[model samples]
Target: MLTATLCALLLVNLWTILRFREDKRRAVAGARRIPEADLLALALIGGTPGAFFARHRFRHKTRKQPFSTWLWLIAAIQAGALIGFGWPR
Candidate 1:
């Protein structure tokens, strides 16, 4: 079950990254602000890869803002959890 959940989460993260890429492209073309909230939702749902991808791909928010800091912190925690909990029995 955990494995399945992890797989699903990873897929979701990848999807989120793709979506973020689209949003960023649109932004460069003069679209409105990328819906970073969606990225936050993805991160909260164990999609740190998406968050990391967004940070680098879109250059979305690497500043000293609260949202950016919190997102990165959460992503780190999620990664640590996965590493700690994903080892073989």
Candidate 2:
């Protein structure tokens, strides 16, 4: 079960990465940019790792504006939740 769950997480991580790439491309092309709320939702839905990588890889959401800060904040919260509550019972 652990192995299966690891595999599933790996697949989800990869999918999130691909989605981030696509979303970044669209943001670059549309010239309007994606919103932070959407990004936060993705991160909350197990996409935080991908979002962090995307911010660095694509140089996206790296600004000091509220959007970037908020996303980072969300990422931090997610990390806290994982570390604080994800242990086995």
Q: Candidate 1: misplaced stretches above 4 Å?
A: 76-89
Worst 10 residues of 1 by lDDT: 58-67
Q: How many clashes (backbone atoms < 3 Å, residues ≥3 apart in a chain or on different chains) does model 2 have? A: 0
Cα RMSD of predicted structure 1: 2.8
Each model's lDDT: 0.77, 0.73
User: Candidate 1 — which pairs collide?
Assistant: none
Candidate 1 has an lDDT of 0.77
Q: Give a tens-digit lDDT track for model 1, residues 1-89.
A: 98998899889888878877777778788977656677678888877777687768778666737778778788788768868998555
* True-vs-predicted CA distance for residue 1, candidate 1, Å: 1.9
